[model samples]
Target: MKTKRMNPFKPTAGGEPPLLIGRNRVIRDFEKGLDNGVGAPGRIMLITGARGTGKTVMLTVLGDKARERGWEVLEETASSGLCERLVSELRTKEGLMDKLTIRPSVSFAGASVSLGEAELSPKRMPETLRKAMAARLDILEKRSSGLLISIDEAQAASMEDMIAIATAIQHQIRERRNIAIIFAGLPQMVSDLYNDEVITFLRRARLNVLSDVSLDEVRNAFSQTFADSQMTISDSQISVAADVTKGYPYMIQLVGYYIWDAADIRDSWVVTDEDVKNGIDEAHYDLDNAVCIPELQGLSKTDREYLEAMSQSDGPSATAEVARRMGKSAQYAATYRKRLLDAYVIRETERGEVDFAVPFLREYLRKKS
Candidate 1:
């Protein structure tokens, strides 16, 4: 018989967990940019990380802070229609549509419009979008506020939409308007997608490569969250639970969720060692399904082979050892290493040593093999 108590942990992708761990620096920097006003370097930022590393949650956190300081935030997921989505939001802001009296000469209704009138030719999209965004910015300027446009999954966004957005932002930059944009994606694809000359401004934007929290951060988060729920667990139990999470945000939340659930199922408020143990067991499969499976699914046979060979080592595997195990030359191994590094599936530890960036990936890979 389980209690009807609410679970404090959120394990879903992009979902804000009960408490954000070790993210004050990034959040504060973005705020410092907003506080400093126009043309601040941190105003334009690019965030890159492996899956479940809280990239989206950081976007959400930044959006909340901007709103608190009276800045309008346009949080969007990158896709083919990114420009269209951004333009749509800019066009429909209250009291804004009435101000943009149309030019009356409407040719084609696609992605180009003479301000506030949606739909026009692709060739004219950047122009119409710029004008609409300018109108919105003008209103914000009067209020001493600013605009922040954040795009997630930027790797998947089409180049055309990206260019259109870049062009509009470029115009605002030239005019020195108070505006900011953040783009988040897997580390591997960020450089290729943002390296185009047209969006060269992005090249100069601050780059933040997000990773995991320290074990101490995880320990404190677990202690605080559990204490808030009015549950009592010894420091040793908390340490055991925190160590099991290994500082991965997804597992942190997932393990905490099950720990709470384990207590709920026992119809008790006190969390026992058994509860923490059970939570770790249950969280492992859910983590694998949520993160590891999708990541492994994207690997090629060679990539899988490289990972499998690397999994033989308990810790970070040396590139030479991994290559020798595969009966291939180090040169052959270097290619897959770069691919995996770019994909953010594996990260270089020290010198030529590499380890799985995805948590519990070694156990999962070994189990599969």
Candidate 2:
């Protein structure tokens, strides 16, 4: 029996793909920002995209980069009470903050500190957060290091938390502190943040809108990754497989994962076109369930109808045609259209036309009808 190979591709969320495609520019600029000292525009990063576009992964990779440069990386999710959480994370840094406040000769032998997860009033949260964060940066400043804060799922983050984070970063910037923050959210939500007067700092930050990786990059990565795994796949076969993904970030991993699965089950190291076909079938099933299903969640009936109507078109659906299919006026339909666009479910194509943003979404919608 031949030795089995572990799959090189990862399809699950939070699993760092062995190969990162199409983000070299971001990585390069951010590392430069670390070296450029405080107030580099690259240090204030905003990553936005539709779901499955790897926004969270971008934060993780950047956090690793920051750690490599001796910066303390604080990772948090933008949920309710996020500012409160930030305070807790800062205080509980294993005496990292305490060391900065106390003298070097000071020793705490069996000294106990009572720091509970006390709820903070919204009005005072911002100030408290600023002080705590500044203390940490003060220490980093001494060592010529810095701090990098990453917040994911920022769309759901509270306005209060947003205000607090912005206020802290603004103070640090004014003081010329070596502080950086990365916010990852949906495009619509992040846009709203930028529009706010309090969060104007975000407008000046580096924006990374996640989208499809280039086909050439995806194809090359696919070939090299498989080759490194000791799997035999030709350049032509790789190109065909890469085309199937159309360069969507998550789809890249899903399709590659399934292709490897198909090849592995055959007990042959050589990947075949048939394997690609089988993989696409499996990948589509997963994509529909994983992506389409969640995307449809909480959509009103009219929203569902709008998507179903778009499915009737062979390509991009004319806005008027979609409205006609739904038996609604175009003016009435435009509301839902904007909603979908903001949510990244559908995007404007040519003038007066819209198309599904999610890959295989048309098939998924049609199947439901």
Candidate 3:
């Protein structure tokens, strides 16, 4: 007899893993905010992080928590017609606001005929989203429940749509209606939104930066996740796997996924150090092909060169030193520094030093160069 094997790790972007490590505090705080009622600060929050940092997963967890609190959760992308779509969603649900009516007609022969059920329409359906949302919130308020709007990849959302959504939310807040909006996106998107005067309300929204997990956290996640599936991996194996993953959320899953598959579950049902080593290689290959290339393709030539210069360093590179290495003036480097930081390809470790935000990005750059 052979045992069936199942991989517990999810490495795909935005995919929720079986266990989400290093984000408990934020999740707890958001839930507490919801319990505090309509004006809770955490109710309107923005999550910012580099790619592979689990921003989307955090949003998913938060939305789940909101639903548990009896809130209607609507997941949306910031695309063309976003506001119109949001307005349409509210208008579509207008039926819930009005009472259902069944009108009976009396015939000349004295027999009564009943028409099929129909919703009682309001005297005027609001033409604007702000008005429609207000009307909809009025109905939802009566039910003592709230609405949670979660936006993912918020950077791609149009400015006009962003304003409309924010305006509607602001109105709901002033009216004391229960509503919450959470947004998740890259670090640059968060910065741009904060800079937009039209949507300054987001500046006050709770901003949470999704940071890397600790090696210890990664180790525990790997060990416990594997054990949950009725398999045991040696401590050495887990340590190697975690170190290879460098505590980035996506890499943690990628490393675990590949390692789990390499373990020969049907035969040995154990993950050895060799399996971990091989899995690391496979994971890195996949990451380069899937994530790194696409991310780099989106950047400007200066961005790539700036990163290439930084890759020469063994550890966190000083901003001034990188500028010198690139044979450019400090001001030129500073410009690109901010650009890369905003793009999330690199992060500042100290006041004047930066390192690749994503695990293994430096290595990938080095190999490509």
- Best-performing candidate as measured by TM-score: 2
User: Candidate 3: lDDT of 11?
Assistant: 82
Model 1 poorest ten-residue lDDT run: 98-107
lDDT of 3 by residue, 40-139 (tens): 8999999988888888888888988988877888788777767656666776687633212325555657866543121112112122666767767777
After superposition, which runs of candidate 3 have C-alpha atoms over 4 Å from their true positions? 95-127, 264-266
Spell out the clash pairs found in candidate 3.
Answer: none
lDDT of 2 at 90: 82
Collision pairs in model 1: 110-119, 110-120, 111-120, 112-120
Q: State the weakest 10-residue window (summed lDDT) of model 2.
A: 98-107
lDDT of 2 by residue, 71-141 (tens): 99999988877887787778776354442234234235766543322225677677878888888777777
Q: Say which prediction, candidate 1 or candidate 3, comes out ahead on lDDT.
A: 1
**TM-score rank, highest first?**
2, 1, 3
lDDT (0 to 1) per candidate: 0.86, 0.85, 0.80
Superposed Cα deviation of residue 277, candidate 1 (Å)? 1.0
TM-score of each: 0.88, 0.90, 0.85
